[model samples]
Target: MRESDLIYILAMAGVTYLVRMLPLVLLKKEIKNRFLRSFLYYVPYACLAAMTVPAVFFATTYVLGAAVGFFVALFLSYREKSLLVVALAACAAVFVAERLIQWIA
Candidate 1:
């Protein structure tokens, strides 16, 4: 790899490490503030969804299929379905939607 690429990678690693480490180092005591604790509890889920939702829309060949899959997954999850069930149902929805769209087009 190029020197510039190596430098960029090292910088990224250092930043990521610092971001993770600083929180642990700074928050030595258990956070007792109810609001802060609640907010922190949901932070990981919010971050995951923020990162994942956009990719879901672009991952499929057609946006329509992805939308169908996303809604199916959302519905199943809202109903408290098992992760495997939700995943399979979403995949099936996407597959069927894509096929229908392809056939129609």
Candidate 2:
């Protein structure tokens, strides 16, 4: 790669390393605040959803199919379905919705 690209990658790596290392270096003791602890516990899930939810809508051939899939996945997950079941059901929902849309068009 070009020198500029290498510099950008190293800069990104340094920033990422600092972000993780600073937290560990600064928070040496176990966090004891109940509210803060609870919030921290959910941070990873919140971050994951924040990253994943938007991509779900745009990753499919059609927004309508993706929406149908998202709802099905949401419903299944809300009902505490297994991960595999939720994923498969969502995929099936998307497939059916896309096919229906295609057929009707």
Candidate 3:
């Protein structure tokens, strides 16, 4: 790799590291506010959903398969299934949907 490319990558790595690390280092006291604590507790799940939802819609060739998978996942999740079960159910739903689509077409 070029020197400039190495420098740019290092700079990006440093910035990303600092952005994540500074928060923990600066906030030494335990959070006391109930509302803030609750919000913080759910932040990771919220972030995960935000990141994964869009990808789910576009992950397959056909929108129908993706939609089927999404609804299966949503239903299993609402029913409080284990994470592994929910994931496998969604994958199976998508696979079946895709095969059905292929057979029909």
| Among all candidates shown, the one with the greatest TM-score | 3
> On residues 1-105, what C-alpha lDDT tens digit does candidate 2 reach at each position?
799999999999999999999989998999999999999999999998998788999989999999999999999999999999999999999999999999998
RMSD of each: 2.6, 2.8, 2.4
For candidate 1, give the lDDT of residue 72. 97
- Candidate 1 lDDT by residue in tens digits, 1-105: 899999999999999999999989998999899999999999999998998788999999999999999999999999999999999999999999999999999
Residue 30 lDDT, candidate 3, scale 0-100: 99
Clashes of 2: 0
lDDT of 3 by residue, 34-103 (tens): 9999999999999999988788899988989999999999999999999999999999999999999999
Q: Order the candidates by TM-score, highest first — what do you get?
A: 3, 1, 2
Q: What lDDT score goes with residue 76 in model 1?
A: 94
lDDT of 3: 0.95
Which model is ahead, 1 or 3, in terms of TM-score?
Answer: 3
lDDT of 2 at 94: 98
lDDT of each: 0.96, 0.96, 0.95
